[model samples]
Target: MKQAVVIGGGVVGCHIALELAERRYEVFLLERHSRLGMDTSTRNSGVLHAGIYYPADSLKARLCVEGNRLSREFFDRTGVQYRPSGKFIIARDRSEISEIEALRDKAIANGAEGISLVPQDTVQKRVPCVRCVGALHSASTCIIDTGDYLTTLKTLLMQRDVHLLYECPALAIDGGVRVETPRGSVDADIVINAAGLYADEVARMTGLDDFTVVPLKGDYYCTTALPLEVPVYPPPNHGHGTLGVHLTPTCGPDVIIGPSETPSRGKDNYDIETPFAVFDDSLRDMIPNYEAIRPSLREGFSGNRPRAFRGGTRCEDFIIMKQPDSVIHLLSIESPGLTSAPAIARFVVKMI
Candidate 1:
């Protein structure tokens, strides 16, 4: 049997490992952390994207739509906890109505299902507290219990007899597929790198140093105020490198907000000192009574996105390509990456 080694225990790596195992390959998963999905996988908003963002021809657009469908199927088969909570992209002013319409067109072009533009009255009826001129409703958007989903994937891999090597970091690649690890060396026929924030560093170990991973830090805040029944978001702030502060209803009573984006110098930087005013200003226009609940917003946690840059040029789309010597590298998989994991696995399996 051919042996395949997958580095990183995030959702993407787990899916890739599972897919390879189903294909009858002897799969081994290596994780630097003690448990799976401890990094970017469980961090950030757990929304299963409806593939509304990204260019029409990008891999992100294609895989995200397919992944959204496949993820729901996986959740149902595994009995994982998830909420089919729909999402609304709101335009707070008349000037932004055109942007909302553009997003609707893009979502339709990207094959996203159940997307339509709703008038202000409909938007207010759906989200009572939201003050918007217009909105693009995505009815298929759902939020998954990321931790439970990861556990389900881990259990499935174990049932398939895929070897799980925890706390084993890949140090280097001596030969084609020989990975030197802290525990021991693993010689495999194929190597897959899905090492979240450290993907570019992992690639460098194999003499592929064309890309660099720039860590973008995002901070989340949880509010004691009543949670929305659905998610409410604004148009993405492409210039600031983030989807502006939005409200996401978790599986609980409280809501999550403010994944304010800031470029960081290192990957492990999880500082929580980001000014709340930034988030306050962004949300004031969308949430009518924002000042009344401003005191309720409290610091939650932070995460780092591994943004890949080649020759100082930022790569906006997901990078899934083969390098020399039968190695597949998946770099800079952010945003819809969680939603696109399954589809990405299928795509990678076909490439092999």
Candidate 2:
């Protein structure tokens, strides 16, 4: 059996480890933190995206759709708690209606299922408090109990006897595929770098430094006032790095809003606050009864996205490639990464 070393213990890394273990590889999963899914995987929105927003030809578009299916199946088989609550992309005015239509066309091109444009009456009937001219309803979108899902993956990996080392950070790589850690070095036939925010640094340790990871911080706020049954989102920002601050109904009763995006100097910069005015503005723009719910909005946690840049230019697509040695790197896995984890694991397994 070939020895495999998978770095990072986020959803992507966990999935990759599980796949490798099933293939009978001597897998050892390494995580810098004491527990898994503590970073970008558990932070931000837990929505299982319908794969509507990405460009048709991108890896995100393809893997997200397939991963959605695989994730649902995995949840069902494993009895993981998830809700297929669906989603609505709202157009607040005439100017935004065209963008919604364009998104609908793109969803069709990307093979996203159960998507349709609903008129104002349907929008109002579905979500009375939401103010929008029209909306794109994606019935396939869902929300998962991310904690439960992560626990399930860890349990499965443990059952397979996969060596999971927590609090063991990879310091460097020597002799091509040998991984150096605080405890000692591990020689592996294949090395997979899935280190969320530190992926670029991990790749550099192996002499692959063509790209850099830029940390994009996003802050979310919680509110129970505008209790919608499904996720509500504005039309995506035209040229921005994020999907815009929006509302997402968790698998539980409480609703979340305002994951405002801002660039950060480093990965540890999660101290920023979500301004009340910004959260209020985002709510007022989407929800009709903003004043009534404005007081209920409370600050939530923040997360950093490992956005990849090559030659100082932002990379919109995921970078899943192999180096000259047997080092496979997954960089810039931001949004939809949670939804795309299963397919990405299969892709990497096939490559190996």
Candidate 3:
């Protein structure tokens, strides 16, 4: 059997490893941390995207739409818990209505299922507290219990007899076929770089240094104060950096809010906290009585998105490049990554 070495134990890496193992390859998965899904995988909102945000025909758009279907199937097959709560992109005024209508057109172009424009009265009736002109509802967007999903994936990998190496960082790559970790050296027919924030550095070790991973930090807040039944978002932020502050109904009671986007000090920097005023202003825009629940908006966990840049220009789509000696590098896998993990694994395996 051919041997493969997969770096990073995030959702993407684990999925890739499982695919390789099932294909009859001797798979060895390496992780820098002690557990899986510890970084960008489990952080931020756990919303399963319906591929509505990206440009038509982009890798993100295609994979996310396909992945959403695949993820729902996988969850049902594995008996993993998830909430099909859907999502709402609301326009508070007439100025934003055109933007949401455009998004509906784009969603149609991207083949995202169950996307429709809801009338203002219908939206208000469903979400009484939300003040909006109208809303774009994505029926495929759901909230998955991230921890449960990861645990289930891990169990599947173990069942396949894939070697799980935790706390073993891939320090270097010799000739793109040998992975040198602090634990030991591993020789394989294929090597996959899914190292999340450190993927660029891993690529550099193999002399593929054209891309850089810029960590975009986002902070979140949580509260049980909002009676939101599903995700409530603003029209997509035109800045292309973030989706702006929105409220997500978790699988549990607390509603998550405010993944305020900002530049990080470094890849590992989560110390920079955003001001409360930022979230307050954003919440007040969508909900007029936001100040009443301001006291309940407590700080929550933060996550960093591994945004890839090439030649100082940001790469908007997911990068899955194959190199000599069967090395595959996955970069700029943010946002829809969690939703696209299964499709990404199948896509990477096809490269072999």
Candidate 4:
């Protein structure tokens, strides 16, 4: 039996462990937390996106579509509660109409389904409470109970006889090196690092060159009511570190908004004021005619997306290492990372 170790109990790590076990590898899922999906994975917008946002041929674009489809299926088989509560890429002003059309065309090229442009009147008819010049209706976008999804994945992996060690951190690791944990040290043939916040630190310990994981703090808001039948997103402003702040109606029925792009020096760094400021700016842009819509002040949470630590470095694909590639590190997995977990797992299995 081949002994493999996966670090992190987030959705990505759990799925990767599940996939590897299916491939006949003895998998061990190592988690620092006592429970799974407690960090970035559980706190995200939970939107299963179509492959519409990224530039053509980007890893984000391809993986997003493939992952979205795989995620939908995984939910059904595992009985994870999720909703195909489609989405609207709202066009707040006249300038956004062209971009909406372009996004629709991009979806076609990327082989995404049920994506099209809708006019202002149609948007108003669909969502009477809010106003828009037009909207990009993504019928494929959906919301899932991410925590439940991860729990189900963990259960399934365990049923398949995969070993999962909670409260275990990969203290130090090198290429094909033994990982010393709180529990003990174990030699691994393959080490999969899906550590969301600490991916860079884990990678560095491996002695690999050419990549770093920078932690980006995104703060989101939760509304008290069911705001929309589906999520309400803004037109993509390419080059922004994030999709502009938007509203997502969670599977739980509470509407969520504002994952404000706030840069930080470390992981899980909490700052309430930054999200508050960005929420105000976002509300002004999307809901200007708003009274009931206010800069939502609530007990919102924050999670750090692990990407490149620098401003200029942009990574658009999954970095899988096995052979000279015996280790795979999933870094800066934010946003669609939740949606892409299932497909990313499959891709890693094939790569090895």
Clashing pairs in 3: none
Tell me the tens digit of each residue's lDDT in model 3 across 219-247: 99999998998889998677855788899
Clashing pairs in 2: none
lDDT minimum window of 10 residues, candidate 3: 235-244
Model 1 lDDT, full chain set? 0.89
**Index of the highest-lDDT prediction:** 3
The alpha-carbon deviation from the true structure for residue 55 of candidate 3, after best TM-score superposition, in angstroms, is: 1.0
- What TM value does model 2 have? 0.98
**lDDT, each prediction:** 0.89, 0.89, 0.91, 0.78
- Tell me each candidate's TM-score: 0.98, 0.98, 0.98, 0.93
Q: What lDDT does candidate 3 reach at residue 186? A: 98
**Runs of candidate 2 exceeding 4 Å displacement:** none
TM-score: the better of candidates 1 and 4: 1
Candidate 2 per-residue lDDT over residues 1-352, each given as its tens digit: 8999999999999999999999999999999999999889888799898899999889999999999999999999998889998889999999999999999999999999899999999988878989999999999999898999999999999999899999999999886689999999999999999998999999888778888898888888887777688888998877675788888888777788868877776797777665667777787788777888878877777899888998798889988988856899999999899999999999999998
Kindly indicate the candidate among 2 and 3 with the higher TM-score.
3
lDDT of 1 by residue, 107-223 (tens): 999999999998989988878988998899999999888889999999999999999999999888776589899888998999999999999998888778989998888888898
